[model samples]
Target chain A: MTLSTMRFTEAHEWLRPDEEDPTVVTVGITSHAAEQLGDVVFVELPEPPATVAKDDEVAVIESVKAASEILAPVDGEVLEVNEALADNPGQASEDPMGEGWFFTMKIADPDALAALMTEAAYKAHIGE
Target chain B: MAADLDAARATPLTGMLAELGGKMVSYADHALPVQFAGVMAEHTHTRTAASLFDVSHMGQVTVRGPGAAEALEALIPANLIGLAEGRQRYGLLTNSAGGIEDDLMAARLGPDHFVLVVNGACRDADFALLKAGLPGLEVSMAEDRALIALQGPKAEAALSALWPEAAEMRFMDVREAVVDGISVLVARAGYTGEDGYEISVSAQDATRLAKLLLAQQDVLPAGLGARDSLRLEAGLPLMGNDMGPDVSPAQAGLGWGIPKIRRTGGARAGGFPGADAILAEFENGAARSRVGLRPVGRAPMRAGIVLFADQEGGTPVGEIQSGGFGPTVGGPIAMGRVDAARAQPGTTLYGEMRGKRLPVEVVPLPFTPAQYKR
Candidate 1:
């Protein structure tokens, strides 16, 4: 799904459900969060096949200024991670919504996705 | 949270910085810009071009007396008495316990006069220490003055356009020059390991001078964030973060500041406060020493991370003193005190962070080579 149709959390994470598989969703940080974090130099993502609770920190993004954690938007089992970030973390800031996707997760509860804010709602929440 | 701007002191260039989209933060009771554009962007720009920095918050003091040089030498380890006119030296104010009080830049303006630029956070204590160390000496604070730094490879070219004499100055040379009819003391020195100049002018004329410099095409306005990263890449230690009262010069790898005149068998030996202990560290090496660390992976190491000898949970050796992402180095670099045995370059170590051990190697300082115009 396109970023315009994705959902976002208050902590600046965005999630987009797979087009064919409704149970799987892709996650990454918002562009606003990337801008605030400055240049991304390193990223540490959780391994696949792991279960994470909502609001659990599953990844670490290091910028030139400081390090910030990427928390889980909703409880889910991790399916795959963005291995490309291991070589070039700048993708998290350059294409945060597209190729910079952190991990794909199998949603534990489909109702949890409905609780996230819509794209337009997230924009207004960040005053953008 | 919103910053308490009302309680913070404003520098002469504060308005100008704010107008340029600088993110202001409260630093050492003064409102200073942490970054103008972005930390990495500003840092990369400074490495290739010239960047102007507002350093007005730093303390500028003048000591002019017949015995000013000799009196000041009693507190610091540098051989200030031998420093010729128009030259500047890096020095440290050491306490009686052989620990560093503050690191500063001392410029010999005249035979009996000298100017000192000290850290902003340690200004009050540094000033008081100078007074307490050298009583009855003419120690005057230049509170009305403002300091600005133009650093990078293009610094000389940009500054020479405004003041022709600035182009003739060499590294560590301090001279008085007239730029746009405003008299300023320009020093050919900087903390960014670049060929640059630090200009000291009156507070009223600071903004105008900064605007004139920024008018150049290659000159950009940088902030403390870039300054910190630049210095880190240059292997220079921060006063409070890397070295403090608990860390001695030898332990901090700053023994170069102690000249031969202050060591044993020299004309003047052990006159400074911590001379006895500091000189001993010179003869017999320090147990722990500051060394550069380059992590194996992309993960950036940060301050307070514990360091180990080999792998995860291997033997706890030391802790990271100052660590951050080095824009010029293209990765994370850090400086920390470790056991002297493991301070050699290429030695393997592990930095513990978030329950994971990141492999780090002991590397030589100045993650990026210095481009000083010597």
Candidate 2:
């Protein structure tokens, strides 16, 4: 259930290199986050091109049971949003690292990327 | 409300426990809710493979009397009299005003004995309702039994490997099977619209039975999270969410359960409380019918989202009652009550969510086609 290619933030957000645009890091919810939220019914993604600060809320996932916020990983302008999520929030679970990738960011602080958890570290941290 | 269930949890089977490294939350107060692995995965796995669900929290009650089936038929809509020995039926107990008392499954074990599986949250109230409605029948709340559903196309294969005789039973049938000498009542029925069996066993034997099933190659442990999503994807209605007292069976699209034989005038057959209102709905089309909805964008259309004729406010047409992202369909889907005129398949609509009107469409239900093993 762990995606080794993705880096995790303590806040439960995950980021990875965007295949369509390698320099852009795609951000999304981690599998653990989706599991915790249970049945996700609604999701709202910030519009693409919106400038965002690190830790800013970028998306919302609502379940019949609970609602959660998805935060940003870096201070940058949003390049594109996963519009598909607006219709299928379960994407957060099915392909959290790929098609479910929330948004892409042009790194404002490439050095901050060093602060994220390595695949092994996140697995251990979440006790996966 | 929780205190009521807390009292019932004093029994061994009702004590909540977390299994398989899954996280647990307070679901219906007494039961531990497994929210991990996602509802979609747990649900889809149960349909194509085998899933172990900790339904130990559901209420299992036995009613016995010379007229048990007749007593139950007088309260619920299912044709209990016609139910063959060792068969089950999904039924609804309703009040005189046409309000649902509770949705339950009743099984006939012998000529004058039956078992009722009721919703976890509604257990206490259902017991009270049954007692008041059928004063002559003896009802025994089997609080010591745990229920586990082993469901999917691979369910029979996996279960039969352990107890080969179960593979031959058809849908809605029940039989007594023993695994490692622990007795179980296996019923070929489930809420997820999948081919499965709901196995009832003593609480002390639940963990052992579950472990045995999970050890099998095809079985996976799923939680309530997946149970809800799977049932939604199959277009099945959840009692509290999709159909409550405010909603009638006709409006919820469950009119087919009413038998035509019951409609005839003679001895009046069953004396169900809501017979008049339900029969009227059957004769005359319902004012509002439940319809399947698909939003146009990637964001999900959720409950309370107002249904409008168009994005520019042609007029409020209806509202979403239940909505979710269907993992199997890979999109957002929902059920809503709308004007009969606007309920046709492929009709365009809009869902008002958070001050924004999103484009949507009216689609035929079962968002994803059901794969029930008939």
Candidate 3:
């Protein structure tokens, strides 16, 4: 879909700038990460209002096979979390880039968005 | 994930697996499928239907000679002498220090004849030890065969369609049978704690038989991920993870496998490798013990999580050995060691994870009840 408008991180997290709010971005793992994780059984999202530094372990998701950490892509404050993940974590795998968004964040610098990988660049980075 | 097959060993079904959407992972130096469909789906399918698993990576050894039974009994803890032909028993190979070397399934094929299925990781060491221990017996690796397991509630119905006698077989029964003219060693036993059969057939026929089983109604191909989760949920202690060369059998809740005849005061007592320390522990008790762990919340606690008696103080009392999400339990489940004094079921213990002490409960093993066709 509109994945061309989103940015991706090496950790497989994707970020989409909020259409209504340029300072805010919606974040979730990419479809690639979700596929690699098999079946998602549990997801622990960061608490809202929490300030995280770049690369900080801000969330955790447990698949039936293993537990993996979802790190912060940039310094930001957690604006809101996806509470729907608690009841049906499989959504993370079923619709990773859309309804499966983990949280919404307000980053310290909107200019940092330029540092993320464009979808086409990410495809090559993952050897697609 | 794709495994680097350059230096990895491949099972008879390895190539077929790669073509069947099986995700590969390198384990025990072998390039094996870690998951085919997905862990949760395969796991739930096995509980409700039938799932086929390629377990050929495990070592298959056959021992023969008039004294084979007695020789093996002296090396492991089990009443092998009393084990009837066409039956199998779970056994533990203990070191002289009373720690478990490995756990295995021993089947009495005939008088003085036995077949052993051992852990893949410990196959070489187990073979070497058995060879050295049973000096005069015919201990040889049956590498020509491939091991595949069909597990689940519908396993009987699925297998019976091919081998009509399968419906008559009970739990732990091992017998020779013909499946559409392909002779196989069928054992009504599996790690999933479900009614199922583990079939050992010639390596050349492995893929053919697996495909046949998968073609059966409700039978899907599962991989190592579901295998591990199913076994953990069944309260089975994995050799390297939950029980190992450092964990005593008694401490691992495996004392029941050692028959009374092998104990301190029995007909053939105190003869095994660690008989002294083992019997002593039977009389006394292990300082620490294995217990099923249930992480407090939805967050899954994992291996290497340090255990503390208090939420935020003192030295670590224990550590989690095997931890993962149990799909059957519908939550995260784990197995770990804790101080013996506080190892009772329902006791609360704290595990340190990510700079925070998380609470977990000590519970009885086998988070789910076994559904064996006994």
Candidate 4:
């Protein structure tokens, strides 16, 4: 899916809502963040069914040159993790918005996604 | 060479590196590129092809005079008297307590002249020590020269294409070579555990020489980020990280650098600094030993991670000296100094990362196989 329909955080995390359930959102780091991270070698995603508060550390990405935390945007419980990254973490850089999605979470508030940044806003935020 | 890496703000190639899209970072006090193509990409490229690194920030000094080698031997614990011309030996300057003051490369340029390559941050102190330690010897720090390290499997092919004399040299051979009329000292040695050369050229010709090397089909530009990972994979310890004024040469796993000629009961024995304690450590063993560590998983167990014998941890048994993702080794690797009892390879230890104890095992050094020409 095109990133135009996705929501973004100032920290560069992007969330996409599943059509079947608006409250369930799949999240991944934006391409800008991936590009800035150089090469992603390791990823630590929260276990499914684990509840996290908004802005809590939900995942971690370790690159060859750096380490960074991925915070949860809106409180939620992790629904599923992309286990494929355990085998090939670089995929996060190749398809950051789609196949490289980090996790799917059952967001606490269905309307929280609307409050996040839009595609144009994200581009402006990153000064693209 | 540079004066103090933490005080030296720029190198001759700073502008060139920045113009090439290098991600410049304040390394120590110097502005150096952390990566160009990318740490992982540059690291991988250096494994198969060649990569040029700007190492001008390291200290370059020359101690020359009659009996200069003999005078230097009093401070550095290497067999410098027998260090024949055109040969290079790794040198470590020890302290009164046998702790390593600094690590260096000593090359006998001539019978009465010897050149040294030392760590940038420790240069000023090392030079001052040399001046005081080698009385009547001309100890001079070369400021007009810039150093470049060219490395990889194809390094010979790339350099030999430019200077046919390159193929004739093997590892650890040091000599003067001329490239495009640029008179430079070419040492067939480098930090990376690959077949490589360290070229000492005048600052005025550094940019020009670098451009020529980069034009080679096999050579690409690499920065300090890749240098760290490559050296770590090679099992070479970085000073101030794996060693310091408080770590003995033996404790730093650099005891091998002390040759028999300089050891106790050999010619010129026990004349260098901390000879009593260092020789004792060499024979009896140090309290702690430097070792290679595998973190068992992908997450990098970086420096500052404490090590313990038990997961529950009564007290820390060791600490990581240097660590990062081993792009070639394909996982996280680190070097640490652990208690002598837990130094054996295959011994499992726990490294506390982010308040979590991760399973780590002592592994054989040089996580990736070394391809040194020797």
Candidate 5:
């Protein structure tokens, strides 16, 4: 999917539904959050198949300065995690929107996707 | 709650730091740069090349009078009597209960005159402690001076270009020198585990001196974030983080500061405060000792996390005193107080975070070997 089609969350996460499987959405933190957390060193992703409610603390991203929690933007079951991040967490900061995707989840409720902010709104939300 | 930034005290180099793209933060009621370029970038640069640090917030106290060393010795365990002129020694100000009040660098300038550099947060308390403890000694605060640290493998090359005399000094040596036509006191010591110098100059000339140093080809400005990581890699304990009024010299792995003359069977033994308790721990060993910890995975452990003796259902042993990602180590490293029985190098342990136990191993200190020009 193109950058314009991706949905953004207030918590600095981006979600884009898979073209072949609209029910499955990919998630990753925004570049703004990555910039604030200089030099991402470690990222702890939730195990696949784990169910999480919206706003739940589903992952952790640690940097040289501090550790921050990554919140789940919608209720869903994690289908896959970015295994590559385990070896090189810096990918989260280097290419946060692409290779840095934290996990893919199957949306529990399609209506919840509409509640997230759009790219335009997310940019204004973060004052970027 | 975050501190009011407007009310925080600014150092002499505050404007220079801001101009260098520093991300300012409130630390110990002072406005200081947390990072300039970035934490990891600054840390690695300092290790490989030269980096300048603005440390003006630290207190510089000068004490001179008859029997000054004798009076100061009563407060600390270090053998100040033997600290030769033009030499600096690491020391701790211990309380009556054997707890450390503050860790400082004491430099003997003369037979009865010494200079002390203390933590900024503990400046007032340390000044009061010295005044009240030794009424006869002339204890004056040098508020008009600012301290700057030039650290790393190439520090000498960058510094000696301005002050040729700095190249002749050995580790822990302190002397008055002229740099860029400015009178400054230079110490051949730093917290970064690299051979470097900490220069003390008039507050008015701080910005000018910093600019001159930064103009060097290999020198760049770093901040507190890089400073912390550098010291951690060097296995140096921060005053409030790794040690405090609750931790004694023995428990903090600072027994070396207590010279042999102050220990059992020496010329001067057990004269300082809490000597009985501290010396006993020195001989028999403290119940808990500070040790270096290497987390098994990529995840970095931080301060205040509970440490367990095993991976699962292990007893709570201690807590992390200081921890973070060590850029030089290429992974997460930490220092924590653990049961003495499990504080040995290569001993296996676990760090409990969010109910999950991560395997950690007790390692020797100076996680990276110190490169001092001894």
Candidate 6:
């Protein structure tokens, strides 16, 4: 896997810098998020052009026992979505970082990225 | 799974895994004691993809003799002789008084070769009854084999990738195939009302095979908690909860398994227990019927809850047998035995739970419509 230094949110969301799409950053749930959610039977992702601010609930991940929301790390509009989860949500457990990416968002405050935890910092935060 | 073997053997450190990280809970007299994820997550994964269950607690037995089919036919209402080779029939075993002893799956591998799968807890008594009922037959125990169910919509496709030979068999069909070079009998059947296969393999090979299936992206490890809710959601009846020695087969809504041809006194006719009373009830409608009920309130109702009529001073007409919050339906659903007059679909009834009489409606059995392959 290519190393792309992404800032991780404490709630398990990750934001990586996008050179080709500089204005928007790729967003996905971390491995911890998938493990905690158990077997993901269904995932409802946010639609493009949908507005979401920092800490706002933007998507839902449903397991057999309960449904949980995936919050936004930075305030912005959803630019694209990973629709592959519509038919195969278990990908969240298999290839969580790649195929399981939930959506991408246009960063509202680029400076907010600096405040997020680095990979090593996240490992320590989750006590991994 | 090795730890489970230790517990099954009654080792002292029974709850060792629970203290570490596994979620412990009590089920069917033994402690489930270990769920790495949560029950809900394991349950959810089984429905969408594949789930591994430890069903070794279930009873496994084999009956072989020249009169094996005849002996089995004397027990279950299904025509066992007509059951072709490598085929299975789902039917009930009744008592002399026309009460259902238990519901079981009988598989005929070859002439004079039959395998019987019974409920986990009821295995001992069921085996005794089978032996006592068929005195002349040669019944042996297949205790060395472990029974595992790989269930879900993706089960067939996933297993087909590994055991290509099992893909051709349809619902209720049985055949043998080699899974990872170990010979196993793969049947296209399951209790969760989903498309899947149940394979009988040697006890030592079970854990290894389960790990192999778990390694596949589509498969996940599930436990009994998910198995119960899934079967409930599918509206399948549990042997003890839905029917017992006190309940008749007609009242349990399993009359279809009793055919008219068998009742006409053909070969091996009238030798089984409960034939007279069960046939009498078959000719005449039962006074009470098992029906499904959905409570109007949020509070969950469980077995032994009394069912009351909808009148101003409604009288108790029935009682709930098994109830729970249906994971798929997002509400409480249950099965109950009620007066035949009040068992009609859409009949309003009240269930007494924790001193409160909750409004319950009498619907058909199986709160959710079944999605069996047949």
The residue pairs in collision within model 4 are: B6-B29
Question: B167-189 in candidate 2: lDDT tens per residue?
Answer: 88888898888977889999988
Q: For all the predictions, what are the DockQ values?
A: 0.85, 0.30, 0.85, 0.84, 0.90, 0.06
* lDDT: worst 10-residue window of model 2 chain A: A33-42
Quick one: ranking by TM-score, best first?
Answer: 3, 5, 1, 4, 2, 6
How would you encode candidate 5's per-residue C-alpha lDDT over A1-128 as one tens digit per residue? 67777889878999999999878999999999888888899999988889999999999999999999999989989999999999999999889999989999999998888888989999999987
Q: Please identify model 3 stretches exceeding 4 Å from their true place.
A: B1-4
Tens digit of per-residue lDDT, candidate 6, span B1-374? 45544455311122333443554444433444335556666556777787766565667788888888888878888888888998898878888878888888889989988888888667878899888877878777666776778888788777887888667888888887788887888788888877888888887677667667767778866666578778877777788888888788888877776766666455545556788787777678898888888887644567788888863466889998877666667666788889999999889988875356779887775655655566
- Residues B1-374 of candidate 3: C-alpha lDDT, one tens digit per residue: 24466577888888888899888777776778889889888999999999998898889999999988899999988999999999999999999988899999999999999999999999999999999999989999977788999999999999999888999999999999989888899999999988899999998888888888888999998899999899989998898888888788878888888988988888988788888998898889888888999998887888899988888789988889889899889888899888898799988889887788989999998898999988
Candidate 1 stretches with Cα past 4 Å from truth are A1-4, B4-6, B312-314
Candidate 5 error regions (>4 Å):
B1-3
lDDT of 6: 0.75
Candidate 4 CAPRI level: high
Per-model TM-score versus the true fold? 0.97, 0.81, 0.97, 0.95, 0.97, 0.70
Off by over 4 Å in 2: A1-44, A48-58, A61-67, A70-128, B1-17, B264-270
What tens-digit string does per-residue lDDT give for candidate 1 at B256-296?
88899988877889899888899999889999999999988
TM-score of the B chain in each candidate versus the native B chain: 0.98, 0.92, 0.98, 0.97, 0.98, 0.90
Superior by lDDT: candidate 1 or candidate 2: 1
TM-score of chain A of 1: 0.96
Candidate 6 residues lying further than 4 Å off, grouped into runs, are: A1-128, B1-36, B264-270
- The DockQ assigned to candidate 1 is 0.85
**lDDT at residue B161 of model 4 (Cα atoms):** 83
Per-residue C-alpha lDDT of model 1 across residues A1-128, encoded as one tens digit per residue: 46666889999999998999877999999889988888899999998899999989999999988999989889989999999999989999899988988999999999889888999999999998
Query: Interface RMSD, all models, one decimal each?
Result: 0.9, 3.4, 1.0, 0.7, 0.6, 7.1
Candidate 6 docks with a DockQ of 0.06
lDDT of 6 by residue, A19-111 (tens): 776557788888887776565656778778788999898887765444577899888889898999877776876678788889988888778
Rate residue A15 of model 5 by lDDT.
96
